[model samples]
Target chain A: MSDLNNMTAAESAATKAAVMNQVPGPEIEGQSPLHHADLASLAKQGPKTSGVHLRELKLLGHLTLRCNPANADQLAAVERVLGVALPLQPLTSSENGNYSIRWMSPDEWLILVPGLETFDIETKFRDEMPGHYSLVNSSGGSTVLELSGENVVELLKKATPIDLHAKSFPVGKVVSTLLAKSTATIRRTGDQRFELVIRRSFSDYIWLWIQDASLEFGLVVEA
Target chain B: MLHIYCPHCGEYREEEEFHCAGQAHIARPLEPEACSDQEWGEYLFFRKNPRGLHHELWVHAAGCRKFFNMTRDTQSYEIKEVYKIGEQPSVVAE
Candidate 1:
């Protein structure tokens, strides 16, 4: 029981790294759609480069918690269990180094932490968070695609109807919107780097769509 | 596309999740003798079709299924603001 609650940072990180290594990383074998564009030259052209930072965010812990934000006791219990309070403000997130929580809805949120922390977070939530709340483990259900080239925002606007303007969606903003036939929790990680959370079932289709959309720009699959 | 903010869900969803309901904030006259014919006609039939920014009511059919108001730009399809029923448009109200 004590072993479950207390884990060294290094030990947890190493375990997480091992788990990620085992999971079949992004299938780099297949040719990406925008393979022909010259990324080196496009980088000089600016943010429009295709396949700018296509990284497969693997083995990251993803959990879904649904509860009433009006319930102050439940919110406090969740904070105590995770050692980080859930971000109640809509579309906002609070991260404590390894753990980050995204406000998904008035009664729902997505909590992300190191991959190995998945079970621990779940156990803690189950033990602490009370009332009519649900915690679902969705790590295997979805994966992340980081789109960072200059043209990435333009490419996303083409795929989704949502406005991707800097004024509307500044850095640190997260949105769960439609991506072609699938759903994506799009997050702006940096100035040019945008992270997309896509479900596993529709990954192949969206991947194909992304490749096709970014054809004019170069698509580079990072190792 | 219109961004409809759901009061229950507390997030602005795509227009696909919403269905337009035209104008809101309407009230029915309590007594027939209390209002004139012109006031009754205006209440029953009048609607604003502004060319630029317009206040329109929408229902979150796919999400919380609640009715809400959205202020949208007619030309650019940009949603300026979204608020609940009985509440003023925050963007245009400001």
Candidate 2:
């Protein structure tokens, strides 16, 4: 693994350029330009490294599943297919390898898998799980960005009103909450890192918000 | 400028998402045999125009379309509590 801390500013810029060049996402056509801030400069500046680390989690497979948790057979089928049990313990997650499942609501969940494995997982669920469940292939509809380092929790509070105290949101917890003008499913990935699941339509807006919020602290954007 | 909490969405949404249902917690007279005309008159006419911390009913019309209760400070327009229609408030009105 690359030594993120050892990377020079020039190297950081190069990595960002490469990533942006490689995975140039389709431009959102009708997105009204943000009035209060410059989104492009914000996305370019990324997160402050000293207090917050931001990385664009590009090309991951995101799927939204809505199903009746009370249906034993169906729930079991999902478990068998995902290898990780659906976190039925409200506002929790179950991770297996690089994949994780977040309980979005009583009947909904947000599943994150490696970019390459997204399609396969969706296929498996379609073939295996049964009943009145709706699985939407939101892989192209949204993206994940990892926010780590110190002050992440404080940054989150600035964006949302949800009680994010450690007692309320411990590790292995996931919550779909309002982030500024948009919505995000925030999952605690580590002691300092959080994985934000944001929709494509509002990705730019949230990215801009993160940059402004992390300005006082140094921001480090990783590929 | 109403802040309404959606039970299904779990977000305190803008007033655009909710519709007010006026007074709540009014118990209907079970039987005519047990109630006087004055009691019925009081029940129908005596609405609590509380100055503060009033429990009002609202429907998440644009969201889950579910009815819920909101304990609000009428003077400042600050919501103190939001609960499902059948559930009790966690904190009592001050």
Candidate 3:
């Protein structure tokens, strides 16, 4: 029954922002937006081989960090917290094992960590980060979808207007752009693979979009 | 559709990804209390609708979400140049 200010540190009473653990107890269940889609059943029954493969990497920690890129202290503090330097270059991403950082804008980034580590990371940022910065735990707001296979590029091209050519968009490049009418933060993970960070509310729409668009190339559902 | 360059992203994205915020470089009056009604009215509602070169504020809404200044030809719909927010446009009306 922890309310809003339950997690504020006593040492820095006046200036600290309250951080809350959004995850519930073991008795409760935390279901992703696509939990009702029954992806597990689709994985088992869907085609084994297809031109495009879709998998929902659901329930991950989605943190939006807003800080000054010119601040050296903030950068070091972030590196200390995430163990990876914030990707300053526009339309780029950096990965440290399970943790991934996407450059959303000049002063903003979207970080994805493991599902259970959102609160831990948020608290760590609060303690270590300096100056004026904001770290919001937006895990429930969005979900990740990993798209791969031979025709993954084709499928994505149909949705987004960004140039998909390898010369223009290499591996690790991230672009927060419009995807099929909805918005998605698209990151290139591999030559044939891309990870799309989509809003939870638009998850069903994107899922339906993928299903409809990939029909020409064939789609395989992976759990 | 127009292909607009986002100075922040350092790339040219489709015009669909951006939104024209309106006229740029509209400095707010420093001393509003010591101003005439006509001056205040002009500052609040007046805007230039030039036929040729126009300086407009545009936002990369779907991309990096950064706002920049764009110098474009109003009649031809040709974007002359794009620059960052704090920087002034190199190509201006003659």
The candidate maximizing lDDT is 3
Per-residue accuracy of model 2 over A120-174 as CA lDDT, tens digit each: 6766666666555667767777778888888888888888756677776688877
Q: Each candidate: what lDDT?
A: 0.69, 0.71, 0.90
Question: What is candidate 3's lDDT per residue for B10-82, written digit by digit as tens?
Answer: 9889999999999999999999988899999999999999999999999999988889999999999999999
Tell me chain A's TM-score in each of the predictions: 0.74, 0.76, 0.92
Candidate 1 residue-wise lDDT, A67-185, digit = tens: 77887777887788677888877666777777878777667888887776677777666656555666777887787677887778877888876678888778877777678846788
DockQ for candidate 2, C-alpha atoms? 0.09
Native contacts kept (model 2):
0.04
Q: Each model's RMSD to truth, in Å?
A: 11.4, 14.3, 4.2
Docking class of 3: high
Worst 10 residues of 3 chain A by lDDT: A4-13
- Candidate 1's displacement at residue A56, Å, is 1.2
Candidate 3 deviant stretches above 4 angstroms? A1-14, A25-27
Identify the leading candidate in terms of DockQ.
3
